[model samples]
Target: MIAALRIPLMSLLAAAVLAGCGPNFAERSKTAEELTDEVIYQDRRRPPSRLRDVLFSRTDPAKVGGVNKYLWNASLEVLNFLPVQSVDPFTGTIVTGYGTPPGTGRAYRATILISDPALDARSLNLALQTRSGPVSVGTQRAVEDAIMTRARQLRDRDSRF
Candidate 1:
C-alpha cells in the first residue's frame, strides 16, 4: 500500500515541476508574427549594449559610410581659403566660415556634402552663400566643377601608386 502511494505522490510532484517550465500563458498566446514583430520592435528600441556595437555600429565593410576619399580631399584643398568650422569624414560634411576667395572682394561661405563613394559630378554637393544671400547658381556650379576636377585629378594621382 505504501509503495502504491509513493508512486502516485512522485507522479504528482513531477507534474507540478513540469508545469512551472516553458513560456507563461501570455507569451504562449501570441501568434508567431506578433511575437516576431514584438522582438524586432524591442531590438530597434534598444540602444548599443556592447563596446563593439558602439565602436563599429552602422559601418559597412565595403565603404566608409559612402564618402569618397578623393572628393573629400579635393574639397578641403580647393576651399582651403575659407576657415573650416567643422568637418566629419564619416558623414562626408564640410562646413566653412565666410572668407573672400583669393581674387574676390565679397566674402563667401561653403558647405560641402559628399554623398557617395563614387568620384563623379553627382556625388558632390556645394552650397555657396555670401553675406547678403546665397550665391548665384553659376558661381555654385563653377565651384562644384572645380572640386570635381580636383577630385578626378586626385583619383588619377592615387592610381599611379
Candidate 2:
C-alpha cells in the first residue's frame, strides 16, 4: 500500500515541478519577422527595446559607436578649420571648441552629428554657432549639404579600391 501511494505522490510532485517550467524551445524561439514586428510595434507600457539598443549600439573595435566612418572623416576634413573639442566615433558626433575660419574675423564653434552609416543628406546634421549665438538656418543647411556631399565623395573614393 505504501509503495502504491509513493508512486502516486512521486508522479504528483513531478507534474507540479514540470508545470512551473516555461514554454518549450520551439515556442520561445522567434522568427526574424516576428521579432522585428514585436520590436517595431512594441506597446507603450513596455520599456524601450534592449534588443534594438544592442543591435544598433556601437561596438566597433576602433570606435565607441557605429557611426559612418566616411562621414566622420569628411566632417573633420570639412570643418578642420575649427578646433575639435570632443569626438565620439560610435555616435558620430564632433564638437569643436571655437576657431575662426580662414578669412573670417568672426569666431565660430561647430557640432556635427552623423546619425547614420549611410552617406546621405539625412544622415548628417550640422550645428554652427558664432560668438554671438547660433548661426542662421541657411548656414546650417549649407554645412550639412557640404558634409553629406563630402561623405559621398569619400565613400566613392574608397569603393575604387
The candidate scoring highest on TM-score is 1
Where in model 2 is the C-alpha error above 4 Å? Answer: 1-65
Q: Judged by lDDT against the true structure, how good is candidate 1?
A: 0.86
Among residues 3 or more apart in sequence or in different chains, the pairs in candidate 2 whose N, CA or C atoms overlap within 3 Å are 65-90
What TM-score goes with each of the models? Answer: 0.64, 0.62
Cα lDDT for residue 143, model 1?
90
Compared with the true structure, what per-residue lDDT tens digits does model 2 show for residues 48-91? Answer: 47988757765542223567777788889989999989988867
In model 1, the runs with Cα more than 4 Å from the true position are 1-65
lDDT per prediction?
A: 0.86, 0.80
What is candidate 1's lDDT per residue for 104-126, written digit by digit as tens? 79999999999988778888889
Output the worst ten-in-a-row residue range by lDDT, candidate 1: 57-66
